[model samples]
Target chain A: MAGERSSMSEKLRVLVVDDEALVADFIADLVEEAGHEVIGIAATREKALEYLERSAIDLAILDIRLKGRLNGIDLAQATRAREIPHMFITGSGDPSTREAAEATGPLAILQKPFSQERLVSVLSQMAQRDHSLN
Target chain B: MRILFVDDDPDTRALAIRAVTHEFPNATIREAMDLTSLDEVLQERPPEILVTDFDLRWTDGIKIFDRVKAANPLCCTVMFTGTGNEELAVRALKHGFDDYVVKGSKQLRRLAITVRSAYERNNRLRELGESRDLVLKELYHRLHNNLQLVISLLRMTEKTLGHESDRQQIADLGRRIQALSALQEEFYRSEDFRRVNFSSFLERLARNLLETSGGRIELTAELNLVELPVDLAVPLGLIANEILNATLKHASPDDRPGHLSMRLEQIAETLILRISGDGAGSGEDPDTAKTGLGMRLIQRLATQIEGEVSLEHHAAGAAWQVSVPL
Candidate 1:
């Protein structure tokens, strides 16, 4: 499945945002392995904002809770303004939190400990959409 | 229970305390004639029951009620006043006073009875609230532990990865963990924290699974409302996940968009779940099918619920049916 997706879809420049270094690195590895470039990995909303300002990122995978005051939803507002597509990969199962995250209009809100295929599938779709748009 | 009597008149406070002590022989009674005494009593130990007079020189019964509630929100309050009117009684009750009694030689006994009744009712409510909090805390703790377990297992699996087969196993395990997490979310959403709407859970599970297919598999669901307890729902949900996962895996190799249909119905004493897909076995991957882990898991889950699972192959597609006694 990885080979098929890599061959058929255009590669995307992705930014991974999560507070936990292990989770952020794991997602970064998955994004890179799925034929996408990991432009930056940020553990806080401030760092994520810095990456967004400096890089032409095609996608951002965000974790809702961050190391700092601002959470991923706040960062998503900036991504929305810049017309950058993003998705949430969160550990929160709180309905109110999910509703708030959904209000930001993400591509998907994949729960924590989600399958690699699920994330790769979303990435593949983003790549295909990017390919078609260009 | 501890009782606080607040009134400016010393004789009125004494009369009220005497009646309450006679009714509750083992009760600890305290009196407060002004703000200083009230603060001293409240700070020393908040009362479980408060009886205050409305026409006090320093404060009204309403203000006294507010103070006692601020100290202990669960404190039961009774207004024992000589200046009570119908409107004042209404206002006191609306302000969350437990009972109102006009001061008379006969009303003292009524005040004791009202206080006793209100205290009992309050005790019941407090117990209910405590139980609900305990259930929520336990659910939260269990969910945290389960998530930690899944993360630990994943980390261990990653460290031991050698071949593509191991990677596939990890992905499958992740989906199963997600199925359990979805159940936990449903439990939280449930009003009673006891039963979950299985139909809604099924629809959500199907939609999420199909979402990963990227519109390759179209889903049609005809689900009947069925609420099941946690023990029954857990295995059923896992079984549904495995069957759906297997179907999607089989359907993926087909180039054309596939149609997957799911139906859930409760008939008499049994719940019937049927799932079918037109893309079944079109380009079957012998490697994934050879493992048979999904099928084995389904059978084991069915046994746990004392249910039955049946699979059928047809010219157009394949179908799976699971029936569990309701």
Candidate 2:
């Protein structure tokens, strides 16, 4: 219990962004319970950028699917430039999505239907990563 | 030999099936489009090599290659990407991918040569891998025994020292020497080390390092998996060790997990070892240093192959770029 509490005390600030509202919510709840704040929830490229423009999100949990002439990759590339640590969340697990996801260049990929435990672990690990723009 | 030709259009398949079968009457042929059908055909009868389109409707050739490799690592794979990236074609060859041929062109005759060449290369590698697998354990043992002798000699050469710092330096040197010996082990364990999978070698090294480091952090290496001549591989390995050691030393608990990018690009007749990373704790560029042990060692290794090394501030992080003759 003490270990868990200490883990939560870090209280990382993360953004839960995906096209699927349910997935975004599910992740939002998980990261929050892990003791991190879900600073924003975004379902579209525009929404992600809007949230970025509005809030200082420490991490971005981006879905490969997004609205309007853009995709999770675009958001990922955008976030990369901003020095925001991010990972792709996907349901398809299909080749096309996997190829596109790989090209976008995230730190690591968490396949769809990943366990809450796995999701939290990835978020925690990435959240603690140094973000100084170099 | 049997060859599996995959295409959705029956006519294309018919034409290809004819083209090769007619040339080699003993050759057998089969075709597939989707993964399901491919699996079925493969189960019924397996082919020695596979010729597939890079952009199939339901499944692409890369997927086919993956499935084929899983099914039989010995099976040769050729990609007919029509007109995919020449760069991808070049890289695909680095990871045991036999060959890449552009599709539907005046290069039909060229395709014939390619098919023959890939078949020989693939079969040669397969034969080597198979024969060596039988002797892998014996090879590993012999190489280890030999290295132990070298290590003993190295220890004797170092001056006797009991200081804590001196002992620590010896330990560090011992570990690096053991890593250097892995190249010899790789030569024996693998079919040959002259043309080896640098990426796989690095992965094994990373796993070893991570285990020593208590396995707390996850280290991922994105290697393009290029193979260089033995003359190049020796120096390339040492240079890589230096950069890798630097990254591991500098990567901190608070810092993001360090990512290392190593690319060996063949520019003109020169093969370049461009190793760089986002992490740095300690490393000196010996080029300017009068006598930097680390820098001089790396410089000497590069020059052994008539290669040149330079430090550049790349977009991702700092880069150590080495270019050498092929």
Candidate 3:
């Protein structure tokens, strides 16, 4: 049953949002490599919000700092309000930023540039949790 | 050493002069029988040691002590009284009197010894203060140099990552490390070695950030002068850096010139900091805006120092206000 549940979550749709195109693409690749589907890539809060409304995103990787007026943190909060599981991908490892991110109860904060191993492991853990919830 | 004896009674004054003179034969001794003569003697030549009767007919002996101590902080004082008790002894000692001698043959013999020891102790105190200052200065100097080395390493790494997508991230870390180095330099430059003139620090930091950005934005700062402890200054400086980073990143378009302003002042029991920029105010929801790295950092900094943070968005700009307990 656990193996079947894991396989189901492995195909979960994930959304990636970051202002930097290269970083966003890199994160999407990591998500895809982890046996998850990349549903969309959003550069700003508006774009990310629109994707959330139009797509069935099971999980998200958001950047805390984005290019537009609305940042990744805002997107994370929006995802949280909808009870969507998410994590933050940020270059800032500042203690204060970590503290704030922790308050939002994210699955994990993926420090940029993305590490393939860490990203895969974190996604596996999240997928396991998502399956168990079902 | 030169000694001065001030007493109301002629016999006691003469006896004091004889005792001090006999104890140190090479010493110069002056005598004053009343307040009037005490002033004259002090004006002519200030003595290294002042031995006075605590109770005088015209005035209290504290007057003489105050005059001498005010003139030379290092001057040793020995109060001699015919009617002094433990209370008077305690009172005199508390008011900077080095030693006190009650009117007796034995105590008078010890007067000379007391004066000698008093000067010796004062000399030792001055020496200790100077040595402590020297050690602290050297410690901060070494710390500053070591922090600079770390910054250099970070910079070298940043340079090698130019083609990488994460090069900007490395550069950001370098900037924070450089801020730490700047903090160490402030300690090295400060006379006290523990406190910083924060207004000057903020000014230098803002100008450095602007210069690094190639002067794309105009910054105006209205800061009140304040001396802050190292603990408060370090985190506060980082918060300022993060805020400045946000303004530089979001406040203006790349092709247009922008304006940034920062103000820090103390009002009553609280310190207020306002960092604002005349950029397009993103009409984003506050809950989402609060999650920005810069915003979270500002909030975290405020939390560390027991402060409150508020965000404001106007048609012209957006502002962050942090109020901390001073």
Candidate 4:
């Protein structure tokens, strides 16, 4: 059963959203390295929304402080409305912000400069879930 | 110290300035007879002390107080006016005026003394605030630098290694360091540098671990209010992390979902932490046995805080418990 599940796990179509271009590309590289495809990389909430509207995404990795009037939390709300599963990767350790992010029911909130293994673990989990659902 | 006197009456302003100069010979005094002069003096430099009349031609003392406070929140303000009554004095004091003096020949000396006292108190408070800010900044700087240094060292070491398992071990070490960094953040949010709200830390830990489980593990926590000093909290946090990680790792096998529960409560000056998972039995995994680093870490961390650890293996799952005197 383990072997069957591993073989069935598919590459996730991921959206990487961050204000910093370098960090967004780094996350995109990590996603691709983890056997997932980076469908879009967005620097602002509007750009992310545009990607969401234009393509089909399996998952989204978002940074909370985006480069616009709307932020990652607002983007998460949009994803929730669209039934798109997402997780947060944020630099802010503020408690109130954490509370608000958790309210959006993200798959996880990975703090900034997180270990590569952590992101891989979450991506693998999402892939396995997709496999199971299929 | 810099002092600004705002009064429409030139005679009263002159008398108040003389009294303040006598009390604080080194003080720089600026007089404002109207809105124009007040704005000019305020633009030059925000005063450390403000003396204003309650009844001014253009603005009241309270307005002046608001403006000065907006410019410099620590500025000491005194209301000196002839048109002042008991109601007006109460209003002035409520508006953050340090002193309210009625314009009388005898009250000039009293106003000077009150201003001096307020100035000294404000100075002490400002010094204390600056000291606290300095300490917090230094702590933040050291923590950020150290975390970056450790990560770079780990990365450098990982590069020299050829084996996959060795790289995996380095990644595990990086995760542990990240956990410690999270704990440091909790400490920073604390009122005092020495202690943290352990319950919140546990919640964050649980979210970090299980939220990414993709609905494979269900987590239920019964965490009461518990604040532990950094010394105890750090080890206990690491121990809890180890236990939870092991439980969840073994809990879901072959895509089988599992349930993990944690309870942290204080009972009669003792803290009891209980974590259990309804997963595969401990006998199935040799890594969870007594010889593994995870088990050893749990034991050593328990011992560091004079705590006791016990493990129970049942047909359904495994449970680990740790108890320490508060």
Model 1 segments more than 4 A misplaced: A1-10, A68-70, A78-83, A103-105, A115-118, A128-134, B1-162, B280-291
Instruction: List model 2 lDDT by residue over A68-103, tens digit each.
Output: 233888888887777776787654333555788888
Best candidate according to lDDT: 1
TM-score of 3: 0.57
lDDT of 2 at A24: 66
Error of 1 at A8 (Å): 16
lDDT by residue (B66-129, candidate 4, tens digit) is 9889888889988888886899889888878887788899998998998889888878988999
DockQ metric, candidate 3: 0.01
Q: What are the per-residue Cα lDDT tens digits for candidate 2 across B44-134?
A: 7777878777777897667788887777777877776665787778766775578877767464555666777888887787789768764
**What are the clashing pairs of model 4?**
none
Give me the overall lDDT of model 4.
0.81
Clashing pairs for predicted structure model 1, backbone only: none
CAPRI-style class, candidate 3: incorrect
Model 1: how far residue A124 lies from native, Å: 4.2
lDDT for position B298 in model 3: 68
State which docking tier applies to candidate 2: incorrect
Ranking by TM-score: 1, 4, 3, 2
Give lDDT: candidate 2, residue B192.
73
lDDT of 4 by residue, A8-81 (tens): 55888888998766667667877998898898999988899898888878888988876523299999998888
Identify the runs in model 3 with alpha carbons over 4 angstroms from their true place: A1-134, B8-10, B21-47, B55-63, B82-91, B164-167, B181-200, B213-220, B224-231, B249-257, B279-296
What are the runs in model 2 whose C-alpha is more than 4 Å off? Answer: A1-134, B1-140, B148-160, B210-220, B253-259, B280-282, B285-290, B312-318
* Candidate 4 chain B, run of 10 with poorest lDDT: B280-289
TM-score of 2: 0.38
